[model samples]
Target chain A: MNRTWALYKKEVRSYFVSPLFYVVAAVFLSLCGFFFYSDLNFFLQFGFGMDIIGNFFQLLFADMSRAMLITVPLLTMRLFAEERKLGTIELLFTYPLREREVYAGKFCAAATVFLVMLGATLLYPIHLYTVQPYAFTVVAAGYCGLLLLGLMFIGVGLFVSSLTDSQVVAGVGSVGLLFLLWSASWNEASGSDRVMGVVKAFSTFEHFSNFSKGLIDSTDVLYFVFVVVFFTNLTLRSLESRRWRGRR
Target chain B: MIEVRNLRKQFGSTVAVNDVSFRVQTGEIIGLLGPNGSGKTTIMRILTGFFPPTAGTAWVGGLSVEADSIAVRRLIGYLPESVVLYPDIPVARYLRFCGEVKDLTGNKLRERIEAVIEAVGLGEVRHREIGKLSKGYRQRVGLAQALIAEPALLILDEPTVGLDPSQVIEIRNLIRNLRGQSTILLSTHILHEVSLACDRVIIIHRGDIIAEDTAEGLNRRVQGVFQTLVRVDGPLPEVVGALRSLPGVDEVIEDAVPSDAATRLRIVSREGEPVRKAIARAIVDRGWSLIEVSPIQLTLEDLFVRLVRQQPSGH
Candidate 1:
């Protein structure tokens, strides 16, 4: 059997058997559903018969993006941190598997759960589509971007969770780090072009906004890919640090 | 199947295992006997390829532990010192996961889980969550996971640490049952565990191997000055005096209770001297009753203590 897939199955089983994942998913969907209802009411009041993916779902997308964004880390805090706290990380690493297999198995499993939560929100777009026709390409692109965003968040979560054994600390630490990445564009300076270019490059919002504009720029897609790989590789390194750290 | 050469590990400035060297042959149950924090676990961790040693090398089944760690792990099944398992996971589920990671699949995986469950005596609580189990059962679960795959080498760290007397015997018997199937290296501070379960004992203290030999060999090593126990159904002073006058007997002390009919005395004799026959003859000739005559074998507890304490300070 593929060790990575076996580990992935084990982790996914653990996630679903415990109510923690179910509770988090329920809370996330309820919050997203609430926002979707209110925003649809407001959209129907103003625009009666027109619905386009970009223009119609833009405002609600922004609202739910934050919710979906926050859900990723909350789901991942226990991936490595709780294992360490339970001392299962020692058991895990001692298995006949590579560190990358463990890291990839865990990262992909968390991404799968995040994908399920993001998939459950498809009802909102279905409701909007009921009113009028819209550009499905834009919705597809938007989901693509959302997945990339979730994967990037999961990567950060794995990295943060690997850094500490406390679930609380991993949760808070990843949130703090994600906040910095999200807010990079918020304080965009009008001082100099060089400064503005640097902030735009680091800002997750800048690249994510292109998906809402129905634009799948290769550069933007590559940006999310790079960030995901960077943090996931960092997580792999963290798992491998026992070679130098001596103990897990 | 296991070899460690000058293995050293340092957590910060404190040395956990220092220049320890040993070998375990195929089909041998070697006991790494050491007290807490004496590098017993450190050596097992190295052999299991959990972490690299600071300044040494180890090989499992002829594979270099550092260079071929994943391969080394593939050949070894390890039970850590702390049996920290998933509390939310059921015993069978946990064993299944362990089996899966060990690359067991399909019906083979199922069979192995069942086999380990039966071997560790976990059938009664296979469906119970690990956290709900008693400590003894949890230890059994830990053992089950380690035994799920039946790898070539099994390394257990304190396999019977906190079990009740019966559970301890059960786990010991489980390990004993795996005698020829797997080369086992189990670490424990329990002297009786070493005596009963292991064929050879390696006494470790302060990150070094203080003694390594068979149990009987260790007893003989400590028998330079031998001792025997003799019970006589006769006068206490006369029995003690008669044994004291025998040649090759260094000293005799009464070890009998005042209420007992038979008087027991300890005869201290130099090693390699057959004083028991002479003492028996003298007792029989004096018209005294020689109820029992036996050599006092050195207990493992005493042997472990002597080996651990014989070292100089600051070594």
Candidate 2:
């Protein structure tokens, strides 16, 4: 645990010192700000009555999810890829660090950066609350769902990063993978009833929709949990394969 | 202390390290000398617990490297051939991170970082980013990180490969300062470094231990029959015949056939014994003015070439 924390601190320091992190943060915040203002405009123009705040929060969640699908890869593309490219992975492997600790430390560092970017979006909720009274339950659940979704994206990004040494490849691969997952719900339109149900159930978009509507289901939570664990373990195995494959 | 028994590593069909085995006592410094692609780095990687050998076992500090890797890693400090480091981190911060990874904390970590920074002369650039430092400083930082943990065994692979002449001397001096403190196993193809820094050298050719001895021992091993050059101001045939008939002289050849005012003859000895004195006496008795008579020094390069030729296939 202590070693993991040490690696975590080093990783976070590397991110803050790097100019790329600031670029990523600036771009993500600008996109969030643009989405928030548009969402506010839509809410003011069309939401005259009938739970305007809940609908407004739902729109913001949808925008945030879309923004994260593109930006989370930026945050995670360098996790393992840069280490290997810079020849520093040998340093990590020879150190007294378990493969899991290195993975967890890098994962938490990227997630922390992701959450900080998410934290910037918190001001949007405060703006909504100040305008008038809003449902705390809907907003809180919506943020919870966003956090879960972001965690899943981070896991996927980290796994893709482990697959290659070039950050370009990692970023592009993660984007392609996330797009495929997001588009899986389209399969529901062409399948039989039973097959459609399964497709919708497996689609991350379908699962995230429930959380956006203030509906908390264990199954929805389980879906994000499953995605996070599946990719996290895959990243771990990818690292362990370095030893098994006997390269570097 | 370290031990290996018949260690072998194969990358697919290519055998990297084959049937290689040697030991380092508690405080001995052993140099691993080999040409490029001769498996010096591969053996160091295996010893450092980065990967297990394909067919054998290695032990470091009395523990099996394959079985107790974490424990083995704790016992050894490694500086890879290329000096792998985080280029963006400041020198002190990088050392602190390595210290913490090595389980150092609080006062101990701080103390070691300060000592190593000063030890490697990195105090000037302790706050500088490693990438910005010159190659010499970067190499020093690599050494400092390896030393920060104060492990019992230190493994340095080509510690001075890319440095200029003076930087090489400084790095060699720093390594010399570390001589008695830890058991050191350094690998280099530069024969001068091995002769200057290492007490004993293990020469590997194509993944096999070709020769293991001290500098003088290696020279003697390759110089079983000696060659001496004698320059005399006399007739070429008289000088060659006089030198050949001398006791201990195996054969004498006219190196230069009556050029200018002198003739040069190369005399070969029958055994490892000295034949120079006998040749000089014969020249003097023959009334020739001998200009020079010196035994040729057998260098490490000569020994390496001979060994490589003698054992064509190291496997």
Q: Pick the candidate with the highest lDDT.
A: 2
Measured against the native two-chain assembly using Cα atoms, what DockQ does each of the candidate structures obtain, in the order listed? 0.73, 0.60
The model with the greatest TM-score is 1
Residues A32-142 of candidate 2 have per-residue lDDT tens digits of 899888887887788857576465778878888898889889899989898889888887888888888888899899889888888988987887788787778888888
i-RMSD per candidate, Å: 1.2, 1.2
Clashing residue pairs, backbone N/CA/C < 3 A, model 1: none
Off by over 4 Å in 2: A190-195, B225-297, B312-315
lDDT of candidate 1 at residue B251, scale 0 to 100: 85
- TM-scores of the models, in the order given: 0.92, 0.88
lDDT of 1 by residue, B275-314 (tens): 9888889999999888988877688888888876778877
DockQ of 1: 0.73
